[model samples]
Target: MFDIARQHLKTPRDLLRFAMSRFTEAGLFFGHGTDNAWDEAAYLIAHTLHLPIDRFDALLDARLLPSELNDALDILERRVSERVPAAYLTREAWLAGHDFYIDERVIVPRSFIAELLPDGLSPWIEHPELVHRALDLCTGSGCLAILLADAYPDAEVDAVDLSTDALDVATLNIERYGLEQRVTPIESDLWAGVAGNRYDLIVSNPPYVDAESVAALPDEYLKEPELALGSGEDGLDATRAILEQATHFLNPFGVLVVEIGHNRDVLEALYPALTFTWLDTSGGDGFVFLLTREDLVTGGL
Candidate 1:
């Protein structure tokens, strides 16, 4: 019993480490994402100590109380047994290298846009300097909205989302990133709230997952809000809405960079008569496309 207790309390640099010896007994126990079972355990333990994961190493030198250990295991057990996202359990997520508060109030942070933000998306934007006005549509967690503000320090950004719940999360992210002034968190349904407003860039990681795809996603995805994941069966309803309204809201030199994920082929097929540039990356091809206002008006897309 002493060995078991000590093992569960072991930490790399003095932080608590819970054993995974009992996780399998709790569920279908497929070990689907079990390689990081220790990570899940640490997350729960770290939270109880009011320390971030990075701080755990230094803070672990202090001893954990019995109650903290017991409470952590209880949360970790629930996570493994239920296949709930650790972010949902922790009420936070890290995106674009920043930590943001989150909850069931919003979807977990996941976006191809994050890949493009860090390096200025050199290949996609010819004149990144000209990106003065930008918009982050369906800004669920406001992750993209905040990232853009940080990337374009000189530019003011707008974050629009239909859900007040999501906007609330976005609000926290905006405030956390100190982008409250630069990034406006608006509760608007797509273009409705920004009527007649034109931007140099409109970026969106919208709800493009079709019903079938959403249903097929990993159990971790089951924890997110359905509104943030699903589009119509074809998955183009939201895309079409954005594309149709985007051109009217873009400057002559502006471009709409949107992420379609695996539905790129479907989009390409639907627009068989037109053309789009799909971005290639080390991981895989993204469904991101840069559409210009002139191209939309000229049917040159």
Candidate 2:
């Protein structure tokens, strides 16, 4: 297949078709930024050829230089043989039209909470300027922290993570966005590092993949750090801690939002007294939930 591609693949379109065929044949799992062979192939081809990913269709038939073809082929080969996600291969991931550096050091940033951040958590958050401080728990790569800084320009965001390696990557990304002053990366387990710090808003995309799901994850998912994916046997350890401790850190009238993957039912079943308001995202309402400080205090969960 390599020999045939080298001899016959001449244009971006050819590479696209070849990548699609190869990826399909390899049964590659896609979820980081794209979900299918065609999208993944186009992303890789565009990234390799130095073309805008969104402009891939415009250059499909354009001829590729020999060097360009070689680079594309190399990336495609790695995609199949290595089972690495395209985002990791390209060293970048996109969320809500924003791009951040990504690698094995941190899980690929795909938080549905990103969709709500751009709107400043509107309606719930009456005014963006009113938010003076925000917290991002389990903030791998500092993507959500950066977004929080952007959403509430006046707010100071503290991104907390347990892994030093993930904090290093988060620091790199924090510096990349020139947010050195507004976003601070903290190394601590959950809320321990930010004791006595009150915030107007708290958002988290913590480890929620259940034991069974983690055990059966695809090779691409296994490439990420297990500490960033698995929670507990039932996958609510992090969420449980967050809900229990958030009331202490939240200011009066503050809001708490969290993404729990597919554990909405399980979480609700566990905390039957709590009233969870699910937020709608591109995926659906079940993936993220919103609560107020009053709700947390009242539920006492």
Candidate 3:
């Protein structure tokens, strides 16, 4: 198998095609930063060669030197043999066109909430300019926190996570973006460490995968930290904690947005009376909901 892969893999495009074929045959999952084998292969090949991923079309036919080809083959072999997500293998992940360093220490940033940040949480947030404070709970890579900062330039953002290693990665990214003054990384289990601190907008892409779902996830997902995926039986343990305390931390008229993924049904059943305004994204139903302080306090549907 290895001999066959190496024989036909001559140019960067050839290697990418071979990698994509192997990836498809292995039934690899592509939730982290990519949605298909072709894109993932292109990302690995482009980044490995230190070429621009966006400019891959022009460089696809470019042949790699012997040493570079060897490096590419080694990475592809590990990707298949180890069943690791391409992001972990490459040590980088992109969200909203911005790159962030990643490793086993943190979950690869792939939050759907990122797609909604540009509109300034419109309709839900009547006055975007009034959003002075924001919070990002379970901020695995601080991607959302950084996006929050970019979306709300005047807002001071606080990103919280329980994993020290994840926080380290987040800290690096915060500094990389030169957002040290605007974004603060906090090591906390949910909102524990940041209690009493309130925010006008609180966003989270928490651990919402149920035990069974976690167990059934592809090997690629298993490569990520379990703490960043599994929550509880209903996949709402962390989410419940956030909802229970989010009200207290949200200022008047403040809104809380969360991504529950496929666990939306369970969340609705758990809190049937509360009306959840599911947000729409380009990819369709984002499974993210918005709730205002008044909605939480008044139990208004």
Best candidate, TM-score-wise?
2
lDDT of 3: 0.87
lDDT of each residue in 1-301, candidate 3, tens digit only: 7567666677988887788889889888788877899988888888788898778899888777878888888888888889888888888888988889889999989887998885837887766578899999999888999999998888999999999999999999999999999999999998889988989999999998999998899888888899999998988999889888878899997999999888777888888778788888666664788899888877633
lDDT (tens digit, per residue) of candidate 2 on 1-301: 9667988899999998888999999999999888999999998889888999777788899988888999999999999999998889999898877789988999999999998985736788988998999999999999999999988899999999999999999999999999999999999999899999999999999999999999999999999999999999999999999999999999998999999999999999999889999998888889999999988877874
Q: Which portions of model 1 miss their true places by more than 4 Å? A: 1-38, 50-63, 118-120, 123-128, 217-219, 298-301
C-alpha RMSD (angstroms) for model 3: 1.7
Q: Which 10-residue window of candidate 1 scores lowest in summed lDDT?
A: 26-35
- Candidate 3's displacement at residue 249, Å, is 0.4
The TM-score of candidate 2 is 0.98
**What TM-score, over all chains together, does every model reach?**
0.83, 0.98, 0.95
All candidates' lDDT scores? 0.74, 0.92, 0.87
The candidate, 2 or 3, that scores higher on lDDT is 2
Note the residue pairs that clash in candidate 2.
Answer: none
TM-score, predicted candidate 1 vs. hidden true structure: 0.83
Question: Distance (Å) between predicted and true CA of 130, model 1?
Answer: 1.8
